[model samples]
Target: MVDPMKQFWVTVAAVFVALLIFVALPVVFLTGAMVSAVTSPSASGPSGPVVIELDLRGGVTDQAPQNPFAMFSGSGLSVMGIVDVLDRAQDDDDVRALFVRLPEAGMSPAAADEIRQAISRFRRAGKPVIAHSQGMMQSGAVVSSYMVGAAADEFWLQGNAALQAAGLQTEEIFFARAFERYGVEPQFEQRYEFKNAVNPFLQSDYTAAHREATLGWMNSVYLSAVANAARDRDMDRTVLQQALEAGPAMGEAARERGLVDRLGQVEEAEQRALTRAGEGAETISFASYAARPDTRRHRGPVIAVIEAEGPIVTGTGGSASPFGDASTIYSDRTAEAIYDAIEDEDVKAIVFRVSSPGGSDVASEQILAAVRAAVAAGKPVVVSMGAYAASGGYWISSEASHIVAQPTTLTGSIGVFGGKFVLSEALARFGVDIRSLSVGGETANLFSPADEFSAADRAAFSGWMDQIYDGFIQRVSRGRELPIERVREIARGRVWTGTEALRLGLVDELGGFHEAVQRAKVLAEIDEDADVQLRRFPAQQGFWEQLGLAFGGGAEAARALITLGALANDPDVQAAVREVQTARARAEGSHVLADEPL
Candidate 1:
């Protein structure tokens, strides 16, 4: 009964309204949010006698995520962010004290060290830092948790809780025997005996060199942890070390042994902290405090902090999930960030924060090139190594103006190893067969899974590995000002704790991010006590840009979905995927990999 013209008009009106609601309005809102976030001065903190509550239940991140939403969420806990907050609060009279809850599971040793340094500085400013632990489990990073707790003015343990702040242990599973039984062969060549990254496939047990190298670093880390705790607790270093080695102790026993200062529940600890904070002092969660603007403002020389955390790879780096923390140090992205810092006139110095195991050789070279370029431009680049900076991690850091690492940080695996597993026989057992044909040189099918490496292939691959290894040692020698012979003496792919690395001239200083920043300031001729503006490299993206990437259509959307799914899988499965990817790289002729297997 309706007229056709009237119907057409109504349909057009509905379409236009839908567009306004779904597309046009969202675009406008995102644009507004981006502008506001970018331009607005940070909101000031509440005025009061404030006691900051730092909860370390979740592990700390190396750096804040690039996600624009994270800017508003205030969910990310990064080492530098926490340090900056604590440093700022040190001078704020309104901020009376810090009450910390140690993480249930262990965090990275380097991160714990950085936070501990901040707490120490805060206490030096005459503010109390109270730390409480519910329990220290025998698993995970209990040692790291205790390290942070030991820095506190008043360290407390829950009643009936066990103190498992004992030591560190790493478990390795060798697949050589299992592979043989399953009719699979792992053929690999390492640069030297100490380069044991591929040992799981090559030996059923640790070789003499492998065991020696592993124990050397592990013992150093353990000794350093004990010494640090002893100094903080005012106890004899030998006695503290002996007590921890005796075994786990109960709460009261821990207090008696001078391991912890008191035994109480978390609530009691919090109340005690508040009482010490002063009359009518209110508590503010660390995250909330971090979200608030810094009370003191300083316009000073700029220091760029460029963070690269995770595996180094070719091409671009991006968040594994738009809303998650996992990311990679893609060569192009990291190089661009370094270049950006170099180009910024206000950036007087560069602090390169690296936390990675290792990845592509080419990618590491790219990042290292950028570091060299920064020095060439007269900007000093000081590296602050996080938990582990081995293999490719060391590659990029080798040529820095200065390098700082926590005493427990693992570094200096200057060696190469690569090969592939011949899986034809294993596949036959499963009633599966893979066939392939190629027309080319003798080496055309060198990487075929159906065959193992021949003599010619092995020789060629070994020579390639030698080239990479030689290049790595040469870079280290030049940077460290050591003789090539000295470099070679220590270049057998052995991992060293930062404490030992300092003695060996592998790392310039044994400290954390705080020390690195201080060194950067010194190198740049800035006053020791002067405040510096820390400009983060690869600046966070705007809200509109992130929104577009999150919901964009086509191949990009599909790739994002796939990455999200993979990241959301079980941790074990993700680990398996990582191992498989490494093997695949080796099979694809990437025979010059510098990696460590901690």
Candidate 2:
């Protein structure tokens, strides 16, 4: 409607405006990326020289660290941080020795072993490691001290404190009676004579099978402690146990009992340690150590450390607790991550760092498939098992080119179980009358929102479980190079230590995470002199996490704050909880996680 010249001018103006907006968008994206890039790498480890202190608080769960890595959604001690510290300590000749101030709680046996391994490797350079604590040490901290204690020139404890190896005990929080009281019927199917995954939800007391299995593990843990303490003390295992039962050393009783080398505080302990190391106590706190590039000869090939932490679920919705609490739906997210690692070309070898207690069978299989893909890609996949890697954990590790586990790592539960709980009676009691109908079977969709599973459905579940059991046996046998019969004979959901697992042919080697990485290096024909840059495939943060950081990252930083970086949830307990929840919800209603059909 206007003049042609004016119209042309308007069009040109609009074009210029659009160009400017597009440029501005890219600049915003770039800015956010830069901030994220700067923040994430800096948050990994502290920024100083090495002085190590572990803030050991809370109940020890399967999860290693409980702090979230940025918005990476998981909890537990900073395992990567631990690894980094050990690596630094080992390489730094200036750093003479390590000191254990005091851990707050009793660490899990597995964590104790991890810490012990790190200390031992540090001491390989023929340096002293000292433990000086006023608080009474729990089994975890005490046992860890023992590993390096004998080698240390001196071991010191507070005058009033001593070792309290309470031995191992298992307590199942049974809500079975609770379920029955609430009018919910616990139902399940387990094929093996000893598959007891559903025991806590069904029985009021330990089944003979469950009792035997539990006792076996407890005995193993106890005996190991006895041997460790006795060997270091130059005494017999029986004598040590008798001493422990009598009572942990009180005052001079600890030194007299040989439970401790001396009764002293930090200053005296440091003096003794100095004598042992042929130098003054080189005091260092772990907090001061900064993240530096790994200067170790890289061996020319890069081994990608894909942290397979948290629950092996269907999708990643973690950060609650990576290892023990409910994190991801069983097996889903793990499979995706593994597949992604496999696709990265720069990754010459794969280090599947497992810290899971296992999860869904289907999910486990999916992860295995990704590992197989990596193998097919000419990348030899090696596994580094963390604390509890049993059941589905073993399922994935069984086929690795090599597997490394700590001597105290709990593993080797080659088992399968399925169950459900029906709440029909509870609903009826609540006066919520419900009815439903289905066409195909005697109790199709019985556990629908409007119905309860019929007797027929329960029977069908049991029958289906039998098939799954057979398939599980076959898979394990093939993976472990055992005959089907032998696999069945040992396929009860039973836990085992790394040492026991090695003997049972369940693990390739009794070693720490670095050992696995080294093996991968050898298998990949990496030259010993080549540079090895450690790469970690930590969890990628989510959209909201990015947005929040963008809005107030500087403000949060301005508070002059420091974050607790290392922490993870127990993956084992978390997966178990997820499994229970999935089964119970399925029994409650059919449509929530609809797998079959509406």
Candidate 3:
């Protein structure tokens, strides 16, 4: 009696809708899951071989990406991002090799050294490292490229490509010569010889001693790089030096110099990748891992990753400052965080993630002291270092029960450096003078707006730094169980790779954040299978931090955007930014002794 055709059409429509719900949704998710797994894949292959390609694109920094959507969350950079790739690649049993995609990073001489040494570690792991350079390198990127080239089982570059392995050079442009011609008189105050950060404003030609020191440091870095390259690549130092002097070598020139292991195109390189990594190299970019999973069924002891980044500063009178995460580093907030963590019985242990280049000394002491309190309260503390933890950074970590570092993490650089700028003359030339009057003996000792630091001022500043340096030596000495003499001998503000640091006793172990946490658990005597949850402190963002994000962005957020968008995407811009940032940070003012050191 009913229309049979109409009934059949309705049934067909229902079946189609059901198929959409069941088949379509899964297909979409699976595609994303797979996409996130491989940046580019060909044909069907196993979901294995995760090689962290180091386009080492930007000027390197301690902090990097932090995604709320990420399954493994951290308030700061995916500090473990590099490790995530490394662990998966090695553990998969299917992954046969690691393809290190290094590019010109436009970094400072010292920065390059850090990256190069990091690559050496993967090679030593028994896994093959294949380094390929599609572009040219000069400063930091070159150092990383050469380092990987040396460390890798094989290093390749395009046949037509040029390698601009420019030698190191540091030239300071003085404004005094130009300022004087404009009838400008500059004024400033006391500091050390090394405080010549403001030299350009005061002098025309470089100070002989200052120039010597700078040159000496640069030369030291250069020789170290050259020697390491020669040894790693099986080339002679003389040969390497010649190649460096003659920048941008191509084809046979590169081969003859032994800078590259082979001359090959991207296709040949991939074929090599397949041969070494076997059939599993497809998932090299897509897989991810973290120490703990998000979903937990039961309540249990938690091991939290507390990041201590940036300059340590004293509390702004219990005020919640904008800088809270380990990246921005406001010491008062950090102290408060530590204070809360020690009291929280749920936190079984603490793995303090430290990556800083020193800040305020007072802050450093406060943070370290808080950590000591936590240890006293029965919670063991382990320090996990990232790219760097020098000066005041070392101060806090020195007190940890144990420390861990990636071979490339710059860990040492003990000792303190503080200085001020006397830009009065430079400004006056521009018809702008900074006038200041002060009361009390040497009240304006730091930034005397009147004139350059008299010899007496320099002596005073130097003496103060001496005392702080001595304290730093003793603290590290005691914490590391070494003699003060030995600490001082190696504490001349020289940076070291995490591997070097371990040998020097600057760190206790060579691993990433996971190792630190695992060690913390072992030290804390927690059962391996005990349920754990990360306990966050200060449990809220301070007003200023929120405001900063409202206006510009939080430090971490800005850095993420900067690295991903601006820094990574543009090489020239990255270099300019690094030069400006480093220069400005050095010239503006200093917490050398770390106003908030830790």
- Give the number of the best model, judged by TM-score: 1
Please give, for residues 89-160, the per-residue lDDT of candidate 1 as tens digits.
898888999999997666777787888889999999999999999888766456778888999999999989
Rank ordering of all candidates by TM-score, starting from the highest:
1, 2, 3
**What lDDT is reached at residue 164 by model 2?**
59
Candidate 3, residues 331-360, lDDT tens digits: the string is 776777888888877887888888787777
TM-score of each: 0.83, 0.74, 0.61
TM-score quality measure for candidate 1 = 0.83
Q: What is the lDDT of every predicted structure here?
A: 0.80, 0.61, 0.61
- Residues 367-433 of candidate 2: C-alpha lDDT, one tens digit per residue: 7887777877888888888877887777777777778887777787777777666766878899976
Please name the candidate that would achieve the greatest lDDT relative to the true structure.
1
After superposing candidate 3, which stretches have Cα over 4 Å from the reference?
Answer: 1-54, 58-60, 65-79, 93-97, 105-129, 164-248, 275-304, 311-327, 344-351, 378-387, 402-598
After superposition, which runs of candidate 2 have C-alpha atoms over 4 Å from their true positions? Answer: 1-51, 54-76, 137-153, 229-239, 267-282, 290-299, 318-333, 427-443, 446-455, 527-531, 538-598
Question: Best to worst by lDDT, what's the order?
Answer: 1, 3, 2
Instruction: Indicate whether candidate 2 or candidate 3 has the larger TM-score.
Output: 2
